[model samples]
Target: MGHVMQVYLGDKAQLEGVIGSKDEALLSRLLDAAATEDAVDPKIFRAIIDGGPFDEDDADEYTAAMYSICSILGGQSIDSVVFHFRSCPDIADIFYDWAFEDLLPPPEGSGCAIWTKENNAEELAERTADTGTDVNDGGEGDEVDDEIHWMNESLLAGKDLIFFWGV
Candidate 1:
């Protein structure tokens, strides 16, 4: 089996806030962790998330997607966001459209995809209604369902959902 997908919820504003802070050590560690695929130290991870927008408490470092979710979401090309992560406000919409309406197939290549609070919450609420499908049924309590539930929660909470894979 392939490695499970990992998802992180971040606040772009909070991350941007720390990008230029005076703590060079924090910035250095953040950069290093972001650039490497190895397991990050828990203390360093905590400090990094503390200064940045990453919600360590809710991060799903091991999702059930098994990396296949990347292909479903987009493709392996979006495997990294080391330094160029952007806020993709329409990602959830895109996923819903494809997963439900059968449109917008995954893009040609991948790097990283994100969905931020820039989208309308009311609209998301409308689109997020239970589809009663196995792909996203939250009743299973499985990692994939849990991950999806968390993604929805993050979006609803006005946070950003970042998907990084292929590492």
Candidate 2:
């Protein structure tokens, strides 16, 4: 299976905040598209979402739709390509936490870690691994703390489309 990246918009606060009318509308569209039986490209899908305003409900929808898409594509055995806006550090943390906790597996060579400007790859990797969670990038480039090395390799291979907005 080809590598797939799951991009989520909005921060922790925005995700938990009240839903907005515009965001609700966009999310409805995303859900509709994500539920389709046809193959979905992360690039095209993210473009559609990025074309409009996203809110907390949008975040939830993105998360749910991502899981659904993964299941449709096959299962968690495949690696995920993730991108998110880094508007708030807390939000970034929340996104990472959610990604690590819910979406991505515990490194285990099944997951990848793509950080935004707000994320400290080293620190996040260490903390994530310390929590008894397997993570890739734990110490240095060659360490291979966990199975997450695939993610680092992806980054080195020039997967630039995936990013965490540092704004």
Candidate 3:
């Protein structure tokens, strides 16, 4: 399947208004600015929330950019981050290669993943493998799965959230 992206303000239920509205212009620019890092930048200048799950097979510049946004906002204690794609460079590099792809999905059969700074490279790979099966399954978990829903600073900062969805 090809890639698709959608933005949101607060809840997934509100995604319809954004998918084709003027916000698409900002979504396009966010996709471009998000590419600034091969690794995600966690400042979350504009907080974001997940609107939908990305199909792993459709990993492309847009999805990678979404992943970048999530990775950064998912934590408050992380020092650095990395994504272990079986053969691709880190997410930072993926962001720089802004384009579409047919088969380059993230490792662990994950449509997208965010490895915190805590784990070593090997540990990160293992964690990715483990979380791929459990985290994305739509059940309660140790962490919030972006595949289902992701949150950012918008709620706390009182800024109107710009949520996102991928397809």
What are the lDDT figures for the candidates, one per model? 0.39, 0.36, 0.34
Among all windows of ten consecutive residues in candidate 3, which has the lowest summed lDDT? Answer: 94-103
Poorly placed runs, candidate 1 (over 4 Å): 1-4, 16-23, 31-110, 118-123, 129-148, 155-157
TM-scores of the candidates are 0.37, 0.27, 0.24
Clash pairs detected, candidate 2: 4-81, 5-81, 6-81, 12-91, 86-165, 109-147
Report the lDDT tens digits of candidate 2 across residue range 35-58.
Answer: 674534343345323532333333
**Better candidate by TM-score, 1 or 3:** 1
Over 126-154, each residue of candidate 1 has an lDDT whose tens digit, in order, gives: 54555433434556643443334545667
lDDT of 2 at 24: 48
Provide the lDDT at 42 for model 3.
24
Model 3 misses residue 74 by how many Å? 9.5
Looking at model 3, the pairs that clash are 8-163, 38-92, 39-92, 56-111
Candidate 1: residue 46 lDDT (0-100):
40
Descending-TM-score candidate ranking: 1, 2, 3
Give the top-scoring candidate (lDDT): 1
**Clashes in each model (backbone N, CA, C under 3 Å)?**
4, 6, 4
